[model samples]
Target: MMSLNQVCPYCDITKINKDIVSVDHLLPKASFPVLSIFPDNLIVVCKACNEVIKGETIYLPIAHPCYEEVSRHFTFVIKENNNNKFTIEIATNSKNSKLINQKIYNFIKLFKIIDRYEKYMTAELQDYRTAVRTPNKCVFIELGQLTLLPPNLLLKRLFHSKFQPCFSY
Candidate 1:
């Protein structure tokens, strides 16, 4: 039962387009027919995540967004490649809890978070590069302002054009 104003739990994308927001079955109806109508089985997620988690094929234990406070267990690590490209990885910090570790792993793999994030980062870098090269464009990112936002909201701002530009004529 997530609101559109919130980020998608799976991918951490801000739902800017209402058309892409959808009610996804946490456990696909095709596989869990009995739980199809179960209230807990339904979650609000962006269409991209729905497409990625198409159905019952994801049998590995994933953290239930409603029941599990799993965010603290995982962290995103981004590494820069030699060619100025970047790759992303999700590292689990729950060393004491094997089950939590497994759920984090399964969630990352099932959602292809690493791959998708890398793709997004690459595209974002390209956009930034373009913005930087455009003449008379005054762009500045206020890292200090981002500190006030939650992790997901900070990411949403970073990924979008939330960084305001300062101009001096």
Candidate 2:
């Protein structure tokens, strides 16, 4: 219960805001009414991952985030596209069981995580570029004025913020 609340375990990217957080039945209350209030059955997620895509959808016999370790099932890899934008993709290493693979697949598809992450990264990259190209301010200071989300974190991680056209963070 404590582990599921601060960050969205489902998407791994969204920082949980108290105002927008949602309680998701890891095992849906709709199907497993007996376990409806079970402590282990609930997970906290961002609103987009919960109400928007995963309402009432259930996948059983899979690696539950509460029961099984998530790193054993999927990995996040961020890549730069040919268009000079960034995108994040899940790399599911080869699993011994086909069912395990399906669980990972269903999790990714239902949450639309790949697209969501790509969108975030894309916007961040654009902002970083804009900040660097700003005339008077330092890229760091300029980006601070641009958006609240930390672009420098991913910017530093992927491209190391070594910009050719603009200043580095």
* lDDT (10s digit) by residue, model 2, range 49-132: 889878988665556766655546665565656887766666676653687777777777777767876776676657666656
Alpha-carbon lDDT of model 2: 0.64
lDDT of 1 by residue, 12-57 (tens): 7546357777777888888789988888888877877886454455
Error of 2 at 104 (Å): 1.3
Worst 10 residues of 2 by lDDT: 143-152
lDDT of each: 0.66, 0.64
For residue 27, give model 2's deviation from the true position in Å: 2.1
What is the TM-score (0 to 1) of candidate 1?
0.72
| lDDT, residue 18, candidate 2 | 79
